[model samples]
Target: MDPAAGLTDVRAASPTTGDDLVTLDGVAKTYTTATGTTQALSPTSLAIRRGEFLSVVGPSGCGKSTLLTMISGLVPPTAGEVRIDGELVDRPYRHCGIAFQTSVLLEWRSVLDNVLLQFEMRGIDPAPHRDKAVALLDSLGLEGSSRLYPRELSGGMKQRVSIARALIHDPSLLLMDEPFSAVDALTRDQLSMDLQQVCMDRGRDLTVLFITHHIEEAVFLGDRVLVMTPRPGRIAEVIDIDLPRPRRLEDAGREKQAAYAAHIRETFSRVGVYRRNQHEGGQA
Candidate 1:
């Protein structure tokens, strides 16, 4: 019997619901370097339902970022296709928001100015969206910090600013790549909960694809957690999270959450995420 089986079942999605916002049909990616051809992603098929918070968890080099980049239309897959809202994504998709691992904020720009850069980049006047920018910052818990410079904020706060910037345009889809990985555990917990609330505020129209290596975070944030195999990645298993909303980090030991974490950790070990030959060299 498979361990991931009977665990919320990966939904058997698409073909029936017909409401998927993103579809990966036999999508795959490969790279040819001086060394040789490297398969970053294997042929895969999946569907992302509209308004769902899908968390993809994997160790480094598992093609997590590769999958995201393909969805963003930043790079074309070497095989198959990626479609968002039924349209082929041949170029960068304009209607979605993408937040990279680093905050990437400009030191010279004020927090509010940074949030408004999205408009500036699109040749739209930032003046008209200043109010929206402020509200987005406020919503993300950066209230009264709008005029503060990026250098003055903490790492977690800077990430919040990046979230604000990505969201100011009311994007239908949001893609986040380890946005909170740099923060201390306490701050990461706060940001995780805050993100859930923000997505809730965005209602049923907003879909989020969050990537992380943290098992707990994936379980806390995802409607369904897509587990991946190591490099040349493909779906290993997917576990659905049926816990009630407004998840609390304080409930770390809660049975269901602990179960999800444990199972995923098992999946990690089973998939060679922790190589048999490797050992921890650092002291706690």
Candidate 2:
């Protein structure tokens, strides 16, 4: 199953769809430093379908984070627009949640309090959401650790807490930036499976935009993987993963998964992004 077959250049692809949860219209970003100005992202356009798991892979400093920030409305684009559910996004949306490479948990707060932080920030009463918070922790395998502080938990446990916090509000979209990159390989694999299960359990209402450097992780987690060029990034290719659902790393489609990863790597090579020093070298 060649994921890249029958697809035109990403810009030439369909720009809008009835199911689109996110639409980027010629969005571009530029940063001005004390020295001068730098273009972090090229003018790029694409649509993310509702409930879709979209993974973005690229070499370091390729504006992958910039793209995510634009979608989250944390930073305004220098040109064009970002729309969520057909509404133009000009500010950070309350319906979106984000997690990053680090757990960023407060050592003083218990896991339960940390999970409830989202509600607190939004001025929502935490008492009514406590049960929901507990369930989220349990769902992420942090049931017994809710009363424990961050310093008392393992790295994986802390990350699970972070995930629980992100979902406590039940956001429409979740943006994860290398969430599993800091964990051990075994822990990373488990986190990936747990995340997949989270998406499945939440059904089609929850969409995810995941950014990682690992090609294998991108293919395994994304419904369609978007590959990007180097600095001043632009879409190089978008590969539709034709693998079956409820995907497990140990599934029988190991060969197919490898092929998908290979296709992404080949695309990266062609775009001059696969050099030795650029590779991150991990399952992620």
Candidate 3:
């Protein structure tokens, strides 16, 4: 199958502006261990505009996840600063929601309860938000499964629950790190649309920073795609995705999307993630 077949979309976004919601001013990270010092991220600066979907892609061992960590304040930058809504990210930023590749759900909690878990962890009453949780689940196409447990759900279903949980509190920013990597191809496509639909429903109030290895997925979903170089990583390029939104999964076949994907693949080749075998006329 074509690699682009796995692509997906969400909502229509306005062009990005100077109105920044998150800013990284010359931010960098380094670590020193018994093995010695290692630089994880370079002194990079970036501004994430409100309500834009930014997809980041890079070869493994690059600082993709580290970037997310610093932005979320899970770890502080060794140099420079990360500010959210103009405040320093000195600790875990409360107004942000994060989801990883795996759907980290409690096996015991019902689906609706799992979503409400966000409110629970924050020490807030989950009562008023229970209906909202149900609504969220419904919006993601799991309408009546609220009473079910994680064990009863498929991989895709569990991820839907995870996303609902993440967005339940209406966070200004959503950080997803390879959130669809585990699902099957067909399921990945479905989840992509579901994710986009949720973003659309929420409007431009939510900013999404999605990290993935799939170039097609990145091009299909992003307002802008960030290409990162190999470790001690720094931004290689940031490509604007100018496609029409509410994009169908089939849009992956279009010339515009394919062109974007091709450009990203070319970036990967130049960065040595993969190389063409000139003699064999194929990729190495």
- Using lDDT, rank the candidates from best to worst: 2, 1, 3
**How do the residues 1-284 of candidate 2 rate in per-residue lDDT, one tens digit apiece?**
45445434767543566998999989999999999999999888999988989999999989999999999999999998999999999999779888989999988889999989899899988989988889889999887778999999989999999999988898999999989999998898898999999999987889999999988889889998888899989888887888878997875246888888888877887787856553666422
RMSD of 1: 3.9
Clashing pairs in 2: none
* CA deviation > 4 Å runs, candidate 2: 1-8, 276-284
Mind giving the per-residue lDDT tens digits that candidate 3 earns over 1-284? Answer: 12332222111122235688988888899998999999999887888888989999998878999999999999999999998888999999999899999999998899999999899999999999888888889999998999998998999999889988889999999999999999999999998888888888777899999999988899888988988889888887777888877988898977888888898887777667775578966644
Whole-model lDDT values for every prediction: 0.87, 0.87, 0.86
Candidate 1 vs 3: which has more lDDT: 1
**lDDT, candidate 2, residue 214?**
82
Per-residue CA lDDT of model 1 for 11-113, tens digit only, reads 3533436788999888899999999999998887889889999999998888899999999999899998999999999999999998888999999999999
Clashing pairs in 3: 10-196
lDDT: which is higher, 2 or 3?
2
Report the number of clashing residue pairs per model: 0, 0, 1
